[model samples]
Target: MATPDPSITTWEGIGHGGGLYEQGYIGMAHGWSTGIVSLMSNYVLGVVPTTPGLETWILRWAKGRVGTPQGAIEVHWTLGEDAMSVHLTVPAGTKVNVQVPVKKGQFVLLNGEQIEALIEEGYVNIGDVKSGVYTADVRQRGSVACKPG
Candidate 1:
Protein backbone atom coordinates (compact mmCIF):
# COMPACT_ATOMS: atom_id res chain seq x y z
CA MET A 1 0.00 0.00 0.00
CA ALA A 2 1.06 3.59 -0.64
CA THR A 3 0.44 6.52 1.72
CA PRO A 4 -0.84 9.82 0.36
CA ASP A 5 1.50 12.79 0.34
CA PRO A 6 0.91 15.14 3.23
CA SER A 7 0.90 18.20 1.00
CA ILE A 8 -1.95 16.78 -1.03
CA THR A 9 -3.81 15.19 1.88
CA THR A 10 -6.62 17.25 3.28
CA TRP A 11 -5.87 18.00 6.94
CA GLU A 12 -8.36 18.69 9.70
CA GLY A 13 -10.09 22.10 9.72
CA ILE A 14 -9.95 22.00 5.90
CA GLY A 15 -13.71 22.35 5.89
CA HIS A 16 -13.94 24.52 8.98
CA GLY A 17 -15.03 27.48 6.80
CA GLY A 18 -11.84 29.43 6.16
CA GLY A 19 -10.01 30.91 3.13
CA LEU A 20 -6.66 29.07 3.65
CA TYR A 21 -8.50 25.88 4.57
CA GLU A 22 -10.23 25.92 1.13
CA GLN A 23 -6.74 25.81 -0.40
CA GLY A 24 -5.72 22.84 1.79
CA TYR A 25 -2.55 24.36 3.19
CA ILE A 26 -1.16 24.99 6.65
CA GLY A 27 1.60 26.85 8.47
CA MET A 28 5.18 25.69 8.75
CA ALA A 29 6.83 24.19 11.85
CA HIS A 30 8.21 26.57 14.48
CA GLY A 31 10.69 24.16 16.12
CA TRP A 32 9.30 24.95 19.55
CA SER A 33 9.94 21.43 20.93
CA THR A 34 13.68 22.01 20.92
CA GLY A 35 13.69 25.76 21.39
CA ILE A 36 15.46 25.11 24.71
CA VAL A 37 17.94 22.63 23.26
CA SER A 38 20.66 25.25 22.93
CA LEU A 39 19.81 26.58 26.37
CA MET A 40 20.07 23.09 27.85
CA SER A 41 23.23 22.25 25.91
CA ASN A 42 25.14 25.46 26.61
CA TYR A 43 23.77 27.08 29.75
CA VAL A 44 21.96 24.56 31.96
CA LEU A 45 24.80 22.06 31.75
CA GLY A 46 27.35 24.79 32.44
CA VAL A 47 28.92 25.62 29.09
CA VAL A 48 28.11 29.31 29.54
CA PRO A 49 31.71 30.38 29.70
CA THR A 50 33.06 32.62 32.41
CA THR A 51 35.35 33.52 29.57
CA PRO A 52 34.05 34.54 26.16
CA GLY A 53 34.48 30.96 25.00
CA LEU A 54 34.68 27.56 26.73
CA GLU A 55 38.31 27.57 27.75
CA THR A 56 37.16 27.44 31.37
CA TRP A 57 33.71 27.08 32.90
CA ILE A 58 31.61 25.91 35.84
CA LEU A 59 29.34 22.89 35.57
CA ARG A 60 26.23 22.49 37.65
CA TRP A 61 25.78 18.77 37.26
CA ALA A 62 22.23 17.78 36.66
CA LYS A 63 21.14 14.36 35.37
CA GLY A 64 21.16 14.42 31.57
CA ARG A 65 23.43 13.91 28.57
CA VAL A 66 24.39 16.65 26.12
CA GLY A 67 27.07 17.28 23.50
CA THR A 68 29.09 20.40 22.80
CA PRO A 69 31.90 21.35 20.45
CA GLN A 70 34.24 21.32 23.41
CA GLY A 71 33.23 17.72 24.08
CA ALA A 72 30.27 15.54 24.94
CA ILE A 73 29.14 15.78 28.58
CA GLU A 74 26.84 13.26 30.28
CA VAL A 75 25.46 12.66 33.79
CA HIS A 76 23.50 9.85 35.41
CA TRP A 77 22.60 9.31 39.02
CA THR A 78 20.68 7.14 41.50
CA LEU A 79 19.61 7.67 45.08
CA GLY A 80 20.67 5.17 47.69
CA GLU A 81 19.50 4.66 51.22
CA ASP A 82 22.48 6.58 52.61
CA ALA A 83 24.30 7.85 49.51
CA MET A 84 23.86 8.90 45.92
CA SER A 85 25.61 7.40 42.89
CA VAL A 86 26.51 9.64 39.99
CA HIS A 87 27.96 9.04 36.55
CA LEU A 88 29.55 11.93 34.76
CA THR A 89 31.45 12.87 31.60
CA VAL A 90 33.75 15.83 31.14
CA PRO A 91 34.63 17.63 27.93
CA ALA A 92 38.17 17.67 26.59
CA GLY A 93 40.62 20.60 26.44
CA THR A 94 38.59 22.52 28.97
CA LYS A 95 38.91 22.75 32.74
CA VAL A 96 35.57 22.64 34.53
CA ASN A 97 34.54 23.08 38.15
CA VAL A 98 32.07 20.35 39.11
CA GLN A 99 30.39 20.64 42.48
CA VAL A 100 27.74 18.43 44.00
CA PRO A 101 26.02 17.97 47.33
CA VAL A 102 27.23 14.62 48.65
CA LYS A 103 29.76 13.55 51.21
CA LYS A 104 30.95 10.26 52.67
CA GLY A 105 33.13 11.26 55.61
CA GLN A 106 35.73 13.58 53.98
CA PHE A 107 35.80 12.03 50.50
CA VAL A 108 33.52 10.87 47.73
CA LEU A 109 33.56 7.75 45.57
CA LEU A 110 35.01 8.38 42.14
CA ASN A 111 34.43 5.35 39.94
CA GLY A 112 33.64 3.20 42.98
CA GLU A 113 36.86 4.40 44.63
CA GLN A 114 37.53 7.02 47.25
CA ILE A 115 38.89 10.44 46.30
CA GLU A 116 39.61 13.63 48.27
CA ALA A 117 37.42 16.66 47.61
CA LEU A 118 36.52 20.09 48.89
CA ILE A 119 33.34 20.48 50.90
CA GLU A 120 32.07 23.93 51.66
CA GLU A 121 28.60 25.30 52.32
CA GLY A 122 27.08 21.84 51.80
CA TYR A 123 28.68 21.51 48.36
CA VAL A 124 31.33 18.94 47.53
CA ASN A 125 33.77 20.00 44.83
CA ILE A 126 35.19 16.94 43.11
CA GLY A 127 38.89 16.83 42.44
CA ASP A 128 40.56 17.59 39.12
CA VAL A 129 38.73 15.26 36.73
CA LYS A 130 40.12 13.99 33.46
CA SER A 131 38.06 13.79 30.31
CA GLY A 132 36.24 10.47 30.58
CA VAL A 133 33.30 8.66 32.09
CA TYR A 134 33.19 8.04 35.84
CA THR A 135 30.79 6.59 38.40
CA ALA A 136 30.86 8.69 41.55
CA ASP A 137 29.33 7.96 44.95
CA VAL A 138 29.20 11.01 47.15
CA ARG A 139 28.05 11.63 50.72
CA GLN A 140 25.37 13.95 51.89
CA ARG A 141 22.53 14.21 54.41
CA GLY A 142 18.84 14.13 53.54
CA SER A 143 17.91 14.56 49.90
CA VAL A 144 21.21 14.91 48.05
CA ALA A 145 20.46 17.29 45.23
CA CYS A 146 22.74 19.83 43.56
CA LYS A 147 23.35 21.94 40.50
CA PRO A 148 27.11 21.52 40.83
CA GLY A 149 29.00 18.22 40.58
Candidate 2:
Protein backbone atom coordinates (compact mmCIF):
# COMPACT_ATOMS: atom_id res chain seq x y z
CA MET A 1 0.00 0.00 0.00
CA ALA A 2 2.89 2.26 0.68
CA THR A 3 6.13 1.41 -1.22
CA PRO A 4 5.94 3.32 -4.41
CA ASP A 5 8.71 5.81 -4.18
CA PRO A 6 11.90 4.45 -5.68
CA SER A 7 12.85 7.95 -6.67
CA ILE A 8 9.87 7.42 -8.97
CA THR A 9 10.27 6.90 -12.73
CA THR A 10 8.76 3.52 -13.59
CA TRP A 11 6.80 2.48 -16.63
CA GLU A 12 6.01 -0.98 -17.99
CA GLY A 13 3.02 -1.49 -20.27
CA ILE A 14 2.91 -4.97 -21.78
CA GLY A 15 -0.37 -5.82 -23.38
CA HIS A 16 -1.67 -7.95 -26.24
CA GLY A 17 -3.44 -10.34 -23.98
CA GLY A 18 -0.82 -10.55 -21.24
CA GLY A 19 -1.96 -7.34 -19.61
CA LEU A 20 0.50 -5.45 -17.41
CA TYR A 21 0.57 -1.78 -16.57
CA GLU A 22 2.98 -0.01 -14.26
CA GLN A 23 3.44 3.76 -14.02
CA GLY A 24 5.59 6.28 -12.17
CA TYR A 25 7.25 9.16 -13.94
CA ILE A 26 6.58 12.45 -12.34
CA GLY A 27 7.30 15.85 -13.89
CA MET A 28 8.84 16.48 -17.28
CA ALA A 29 8.37 15.14 -20.75
CA HIS A 30 4.86 16.45 -20.37
CA GLY A 31 4.71 14.50 -17.16
CA TRP A 32 5.78 11.32 -18.83
CA SER A 33 3.12 11.74 -21.47
CA THR A 34 0.50 12.41 -18.84
CA GLY A 35 1.46 9.44 -16.72
CA ILE A 36 1.57 7.02 -19.63
CA VAL A 37 -1.95 7.78 -20.74
CA SER A 38 -3.47 7.45 -17.30
CA LEU A 39 -1.72 4.19 -16.44
CA MET A 40 -2.32 2.61 -19.81
CA SER A 41 -6.00 3.46 -19.64
CA ASN A 42 -7.55 3.66 -16.19
CA TYR A 43 -5.30 0.98 -14.58
CA VAL A 44 -3.94 -2.51 -14.93
CA LEU A 45 -6.02 -5.66 -15.37
CA GLY A 46 -7.36 -3.55 -18.19
CA VAL A 47 -4.09 -3.09 -20.08
CA VAL A 48 -4.15 -0.56 -22.86
CA PRO A 49 -0.98 1.15 -24.10
CA THR A 50 -2.62 1.84 -27.44
CA THR A 51 -0.37 -0.71 -29.11
CA PRO A 52 2.24 0.27 -31.73
CA GLY A 53 5.64 -0.64 -30.28
CA LEU A 54 4.00 0.16 -26.93
CA GLU A 55 6.33 3.12 -26.47
CA THR A 56 9.22 0.69 -26.00
CA TRP A 57 8.25 -0.44 -22.50
CA ILE A 58 8.72 3.00 -20.94
CA LEU A 59 10.96 3.59 -17.91
CA ARG A 60 11.90 7.25 -17.59
CA TRP A 61 13.95 9.56 -15.39
CA ALA A 62 16.51 11.93 -16.81
CA LYS A 63 17.18 14.44 -14.05
CA GLY A 64 14.42 16.36 -12.28
CA ARG A 65 12.92 19.84 -12.86
CA VAL A 66 10.23 18.08 -14.89
CA GLY A 67 7.64 19.59 -12.50
CA THR A 68 4.69 18.09 -14.31
CA PRO A 69 5.66 14.60 -15.26
CA GLN A 70 4.48 11.76 -13.05
CA GLY A 71 3.47 8.19 -13.82
CA ALA A 72 2.60 4.91 -12.01
CA ILE A 73 1.22 1.55 -13.21
CA GLU A 74 1.20 -2.08 -11.98
CA VAL A 75 -0.64 -5.27 -12.90
CA HIS A 76 -0.49 -8.88 -11.70
CA TRP A 77 -2.88 -11.76 -12.11
CA THR A 78 -3.00 -15.53 -11.74
CA LEU A 79 -5.92 -17.23 -13.45
CA GLY A 80 -8.21 -16.30 -16.31
CA GLU A 81 -10.14 -13.21 -17.44
CA ASP A 82 -8.44 -9.89 -18.35
CA ALA A 83 -9.50 -6.40 -19.34
CA MET A 84 -7.69 -3.04 -19.75
CA SER A 85 -8.65 0.23 -21.33
CA VAL A 86 -7.01 3.71 -21.52
CA HIS A 87 -7.64 7.09 -23.09
CA LEU A 88 -6.58 10.57 -21.98
CA THR A 89 -6.02 13.96 -23.61
CA VAL A 90 -5.84 16.24 -20.63
CA PRO A 91 -3.94 19.56 -20.70
CA ALA A 92 -6.30 22.43 -19.93
CA GLY A 93 -5.64 22.66 -16.23
CA THR A 94 -5.75 18.93 -15.68
CA LYS A 95 -6.42 16.88 -12.58
CA VAL A 96 -7.35 13.21 -12.50
CA ASN A 97 -7.23 10.51 -9.83
CA VAL A 98 -8.61 7.07 -10.56
CA GLN A 99 -7.72 4.34 -8.06
CA VAL A 100 -9.46 0.97 -7.89
CA PRO A 101 -8.62 -1.91 -5.59
CA VAL A 102 -11.36 -3.85 -3.86
CA LYS A 103 -10.25 -7.39 -3.34
CA LYS A 104 -11.53 -9.73 -0.67
CA GLY A 105 -13.99 -11.43 -2.91
CA GLN A 106 -13.90 -9.29 -6.06
CA PHE A 107 -16.11 -6.59 -7.63
CA VAL A 108 -15.30 -3.07 -8.88
CA LEU A 109 -17.12 -0.74 -11.18
CA LEU A 110 -16.28 2.88 -11.98
CA ASN A 111 -18.76 5.40 -13.30
CA GLY A 112 -19.07 8.18 -10.74
CA GLU A 113 -16.64 8.39 -7.88
CA GLN A 114 -14.88 5.74 -5.79
CA ILE A 115 -12.26 8.28 -6.63
CA GLU A 116 -13.12 9.09 -10.20
CA ALA A 117 -12.95 12.78 -11.03
CA LEU A 118 -11.08 14.58 -13.75
CA ILE A 119 -10.72 18.32 -14.15
CA GLU A 120 -10.18 19.70 -17.60
CA GLU A 121 -11.16 16.10 -17.71
CA GLY A 122 -11.17 14.32 -20.99
CA TYR A 123 -12.05 10.65 -20.80
CA VAL A 124 -11.66 8.01 -18.06
CA ASN A 125 -13.61 4.77 -17.74
CA ILE A 126 -12.29 1.64 -16.02
CA GLY A 127 -12.96 -2.10 -15.90
CA ASP A 128 -11.40 -5.17 -14.24
CA VAL A 129 -12.70 -8.39 -12.78
CA LYS A 130 -14.04 -11.81 -13.67
CA SER A 131 -11.64 -13.80 -11.66
CA GLY A 132 -9.64 -12.18 -8.82
CA VAL A 133 -6.88 -9.66 -9.28
CA TYR A 134 -7.09 -5.89 -9.04
CA THR A 135 -4.92 -2.81 -8.72
CA ALA A 136 -5.60 0.36 -10.56
CA ASP A 137 -4.16 3.70 -9.50
CA VAL A 138 -4.39 6.74 -11.73
CA ARG A 139 -3.16 10.22 -10.95
CA GLN A 140 -3.28 12.95 -13.51
CA ARG A 141 -1.38 16.12 -14.47
CA GLY A 142 1.65 14.12 -13.37
CA SER A 143 0.39 10.71 -14.42
CA VAL A 144 0.41 7.43 -12.46
CA ALA A 145 -1.07 3.90 -12.44
CA CYS A 146 0.58 1.39 -10.13
CA LYS A 147 -0.71 -1.70 -11.78
CA PRO A 148 -1.17 -5.37 -10.62
CA GLY A 149 -4.11 -7.28 -9.25
Pick by TM-score: which candidate is best? Answer: 1
Model 1 agreement with the true structure over 1-149: per-residue lDDT tens digits: 01155553233333344333546465332344345655886755545556765677655444676789987788876665566677888888755566767544534766655556567887777757778777766655344444334
RMSD (CA, angstroms), candidate 2: 19.6
Stretches of model 1 off by over 4 angstroms after superposition: 1-62, 103-107, 139-149
lDDT of 2 at 21: 35
- lDDT value for model 2: 0.34
Q: How many residue pairs clash in all the candidates, one count each?
A: 8, 40
TM-score of 2: 0.16
**Residue 136 in model 2: lDDT:** 36
lDDT of each: 0.60, 0.34
lDDT per residue for candidate 2 within 31-101, as digits (tens), equals 44346556644354344345575663432111111134433232332222233322222223434454332
